[model samples]
Target: MDLLVVGGGPVGLVVALRAADAGLTVTVLEPRHGPVDKACGEGLMPAARERLAQVGAAPNGHDLASIVYTDGRHRVSAPLTRPGLGVRRTVLHAALLEAADRAGVQVRHTRMIGIEPGDPRDHARPARVRTSDGQERTAPFVVAADGLHSPTRRALGLERPARLPRRFGLRAHYAVAPWSDAVEVHWSRNAEAYVTPVADDLVGVALLCRPPGRWDPTWRSFPELAWRLAGSEQTSAVRGAGPLRQRVRSMVRGRVLLVGDAAGYVDALTGEGLTLGTAQAFAAVDAVLAGSPAQYARRAPALGRRSTLLTRGLLAVSGQPAIRRLIVPAAARVPAVYRGAVHQLAGGH
Candidate 1:
């Protein structure tokens, strides 16, 4: 294989499909297969939706034109000038997997446990991979799409922990049909809930907050959201993910490169995690085909800066009550600026 991609999540499958499209052989390694689930906002930015279409991986989901942020008292709603979609994580994964298969990218069920960098003395030599089956494989280039807690990153000394306070997320799907055409982000003093319509009769709710101190059945903090989801039966079990901030030392080292959340992550506050990862997959494959893997380090992050900034900014405000109080009101006051910000974050800038 010309490329060995670790972690067959969205980004990994993306790299495989894109690389194969570029006429390069590719193999993806991931232990778990099928419709894998995770805690995610589950809303794709407009740019991401288009890119997936270009690569033949667009999945079926509800259309989302706008984003509405409400603190119960104050609210800011901005329509996307570009196209965006609300799709379940499993559905998205299945689409990408189908695309990869169609493109002839090999899918392996084994896991990559370790990597041995190519020697500098032999420029043509490929890196060696140790698999879960205790077999070794070699490839000219390797991509670490393993995700936020990437073992490949730590094994290569690329971990860089951020100073920001840790936050976690929990997600579940409700059987109720969506009541709104746009994604609704309900903000409160203690937590923020993201409501994304993934299907005609299924909406996914992901809750973000500091870990709970004690179990409480009542969601008194977010009365409006609780009321809407009150008696709706849950279609999926609650899935959690966190310590949402991940930092990295660099994206490229020797024959290995980090893509998607494996490269770095801030928060899902901006709902662009998969979008930026899709962009990175494009950059990484192009760099590999150009025989200049180092270029990806400089290019991929540039494609994601706007989303990263917005994510960090939102996290900061969400952590501070005073600023949190201002978000909706400020956006409401300057609708033009808020719309421009939304467009910019959508990669339309």
Candidate 2:
């Protein structure tokens, strides 16, 4: 094979498809079968939509809109003229798998165990990968999209940069009429609740907070905000995701490369994780085809820097109670600043 891609998530699948389209023999190894489950905000930003189109996998038949931010009382809604499409993880995965198949990439459902990096024999013996099923495979170039906790990264001995003030995430879906077409992020002193309209009658809610496991008290703690969103039927079981932080570093080493959360992650506040991963997939394919791993290493950081910076800045502001109080009021006062922030968060900027 010309390339071996680890993790059959959207990012891995996109890389496989793009490489295959460019006439390289491609294979993808994933631990799970089709329709893999991922914990995410599931809001496809405008940048993600554009990259999907480039890969011939644009989200279709979905209601599209911008995003809205609120401090519980005052709200500012901005029209994301570029508009983002809302698709569940399963739906998006299925689309990418189909595209990958059509583009002639072979996908294997198997858990990866180890990799042989920098071995001269890696070119001839190829990189050896052991699967959970006791099967072994080899390919010259490997792209790891295995996610935040990646075995591939560990095997390569790459150190992940520290993210200050670790946080956790909780998420669930609701069956009810959407309050608006836009995604609503309601900010509080220590945490924020993100409400994204995924369809005409369904919305996804994700809550983020610092660790040591606070937030156990539900409605009692956030009475007003909870009361306002009461009565909506829960469509899916409530789930949690994270330990989110700023993971700043290069995503490539030797023939092994990282895309998506495996490379580096940003705070989920920006809701741009999936979008950034998809964009990196394209850049990874290009760098590999050009036979320049250094170029691949150089490219991933630039792609995620802006969004990561914005996320870090927001995290700092949200971390301080006094700053948040002053910032929210000032942001509410100047609607343009709020709107611009929303636009950038929606991946327009």
Candidate 3:
């Protein structure tokens, strides 16, 4: 194969599609079935939506026009420079799978158990991988988009220890009608509730918190949200992911390039995961096409620097209860700053 993309999630599929569009044969390795779902704030920022369309994986969902920050008593709203989309993970995954099928990208239903990096100096040499079934595969270029806590990243010795306080995220869907065209982020003392409208009759609520014990995303924690969701039937089970941060030593090793969460991740506080992941996917293929996968290491960081800095800064301030109480008020007081940040997040930069 010309490219081996490990991890069949949206980002990995994107890498395959882009490479296939360039006339390179691509194979994706994934243990899970198609249309896989995960615990995530499923709101796609404007750039993410655009990139999905650009890559021929556009999925239908509710239109998202803005972000609203609230602390019950205080609220601040910022409009996205371009409208975004609030899509369910499975919906997004299915679209990508279809797009990959149309592009002739083959997907293997197995996990990568081992890898041997190719000679970085010889672009023609193939990197090899051992699958769970004891089969071996080789490709000139490999992109790992295996997500947070990626085994591929660990095996490659790219994982970095995160020193900050650990945080977690829990997401569930509710069979409730759309409330607004905005993604609502409700602030509380211990956690934040991110409510996104994914369909006319479905909404996704994700809670990000520094858990005190077990991972319980208690809705009562946010009285306002609880009241709003009272008696609403849940459409899906609660799903969770965390420490919410993954640091990486670098994005490339020999012919292997890491994309998506496998590359590294910050908190999902800003809802930039898909946007950054797709950008990295494109860059990974570009580097591979240039016959130097190492260029991806230099290119990927710039794609996520702004998001990393902003998420870390927000997490730092919000970790302190005293300052956390001021976040919504601060945004309400300085609308322009909040608006500019939203614009940046929406890729207006």
Please give the CA lDDT of all the candidate structures: 0.84, 0.76, 0.89
True-structure RMSD, every candidate: 1.7, 2.5, 1.3
Candidate 1 structure, TM-score to reference: 0.95
TM-score of each: 0.95, 0.91, 0.97
What is the overall TM-score of model 2 with all chains considered together? 0.91
lDDT of 3 by residue, 1-349 (tens): 7899999999999899999999899999999986998999999998888888887888989999999999999999999888899999999999999999998899999999999878879856679899997899998888999999898899999988997688888899999998899999998887888999999999999988876624343466678888888888987998989888899898888888999999888888988899899899999999999988768878889998887889889999998899999999999999999998888877775
* Model 2 alpha-carbon miss at residue 139, Å: 2.0
TM-score of 3: 0.97
The regions of model 3 sitting more than 4 angstroms off are: 213-218
What's the true lDDT of residue 22 in model 2? Answer: 88
Model 1 lDDT tens row, 142-184: 9889998998998899898677587788888889889987889
Top model number, lDDT: 3
Rank all candidate structures by their lDDT, best first, as comma-separated numbers.
3, 1, 2
* Candidate 1 regions with alpha-carbon error over 4 angstroms: 119-122, 213-218
Off by over 4 Å in 2: 60-62, 119-126, 212-228, 246-249
1 against 3, candidate with superior lDDT: 3
